[model samples]
Target: MVRLPLTPAEVARGQRLGALLRRARGERSMLDIALDAHVSPETLRKIESGRVATPAFPTIAAIADVLGLSLDAVWAEISRPEHDVTPAASAHTRPERLTA
Candidate 1:
């Protein structure tokens, strides 16, 4: 059966997911992680670089499993605000109000 191409939104989501995975994988060799995930190093490289946007679900599951991270956590990271100001603003404001 022919698989349908991914939508633009799905591609963006996949890229975001890949970026999150990369961040969580700091200090780990891509080859090692890929081997653990049961995917080729080149495939992992492409996923990390967002060259292969919309990677298969099983592929993502494998990577997430090897990373020891939950799927929900990965999705949450991807969906997090690109420019999260709440934490930064709260850090400054919370101290002032408590002192005042």
Candidate 2:
């Protein structure tokens, strides 16, 4: 299939997703997390580095599971564009706070 180029918003969201995952992963080795998530280290690297701008849902779900992150939390994170990209702000903010 011919894929259209990603818009700026999509690319930005992907970067936010990557940053969130990297923070949630903390000091854990990427190899270990990738293995546990049943994905290749290269895939994890791409996602974490924001190179794979719109990863498949299953791929993201698997990695999020390994990182002990809930989908709600993940959405809450990447959905917010104006918030500061801190680990605490990204991983723990309430969705309502996005408007507050």
Give the number of the best model, judged by lDDT: 2
lDDT of 1 by residue, 45-84 (tens): 9998888887787898788777766666665555556554
* Residue runs of model 2 more than 4 Å from their true location after superposition: 83-100
lDDT of each: 0.70, 0.81
lDDT of 2: 0.81
TM-score of 1: 0.70
Q: CA shift at 80, candidate 2, in angstroms?
A: 1.0
Model 1, poorest ten-residue lDDT window?
91-100
Q: Report the C-alpha displacement of residue 59, candidate 1, in angstroms.
A: 0.8
Q: What lDDT score is found at residue 95 in candidate 2? A: 44
lDDT score at residue 53, model 1, on the 0-100 scale: 80
CA lDDT, candidate 2, residue 21: 88
**Which structure among the candidates has the greatest TM-score?**
2
